[model samples]
Target: MSWKGFSLDSATSERRRPGASRVTAVKILIAGGFGAGKTTLVGAISEIPPLTTEAIMTAAGVGVDDTGGVPGKSTTTVAMDFGRITIAEDLILYLFGTPGQNRFWFMWDELARGALGAVVIVDTRRIEDSFAALDFFEHLGLPYLAAVNCFEGAPRYDAEEVRQALAIAGHVPLALFDARSRDSVRQTLIAVAEHALRTLTAGRPRP
Candidate 1:
């Protein structure tokens, strides 16, 4: 077999399967408010079929959950969504989507554990939707990048203004992304990996 034109054969294959792509695993958390398109982004960029655990909204979950921010949003992630993408010979990113509704907030830490980093997808028209994601990353001390998802015909705001409004630090990586595009989602993962690498290498955190 061959991976990216690198053949795996002979003694190498017998021993360790050379050039068939190494098992380099990296966990990345995909988080945002309800209907921010976290699952779509993961599915768009993933090299494998995305695994999603979703549930329908209920009447009891109405007031307890923050529906004000995501009026147009209907469904929500219940357990988690999983996806994968191989960026290079060794850069394989695994995306785990967290629940967006406030009721599922208890699982935040478990979902984020051992993650390389996280991407906080933002709905600029409903910026407050992403507050939980921001708070989770900040409190957990997880290195993360913020990507503003451009909704169709939604009002726009300058990146700087959004950052300031969200109180996101200037040093934290930030950019605009479209969850539906493979290229766009891939870039977001790249940004996340790069940011996490920098933070880990700087000795801020490990594993």
Candidate 2:
């Protein structure tokens, strides 16, 4: 869609509830490999219209960007996608979807600053494509969960099987979902928030 600048005051006014306590906005990053449905997940779950910077793929990117698994994909997210959702009367979530290509990964360090956690979306067919994202988050020690986006006609695997294939840690949350479904996306976000909160609590220093 169209792009516009974001402001805290404006976002608060739009998402605030009557007689609610002060708002707490938590930032989360949506990350994955190219064509893994990061943009679609944000758009499906966001209350406000999502801001996206997408450009049509051209011959120029043929050598640089790999399109082996997703040959039909014609567009790419050139920058981050922004969206907002209210989890409770006093709690809001700001979602930032990172650009998937390696070249755009430099922006992730900035996008991930102050983020409470992240969601790594995976395509079953291109499971290997998500390794970079997993490594990035793990290296930075950011709390995150893995979501397997069920694409049509794509091979399906159970959560445990996928987790083993990805070599995800035992404590990390892993789930299956369809990015296009609002309910599924919402559930996935809830899982991520729960996992993040647990990690934070566990890491707290004892009094």
How does model 2 fare in lDDT?
0.84
| Residue 165 CA displacement from its true place in model 2, Å | 1.0
Off by over 4 Å in 1: 1-18
lDDT of 1 by residue, 69-110 (tens): 567666789878999887766556778999887778788888
lDDT for model 1, on a 0 to 1 scale?
A: 0.78
lDDT tens per residue, model 2, 1-207: 111122333222333447855566778899999999999999999999999998999999989998888888999999899999877666678999999998898899889887777999999989998899999999888889999999787899988999999999998999899999999998998888777767765773211
User: lDDT (CA) for every model shown?
Assistant: 0.78, 0.84
Candidate 2 RMSD to the real structure? 6.3
- Candidate 2 — worst ten consecutive residues by lDDT sum? 1-10
Q: Judged by TM-score, which candidate is best?
A: 2
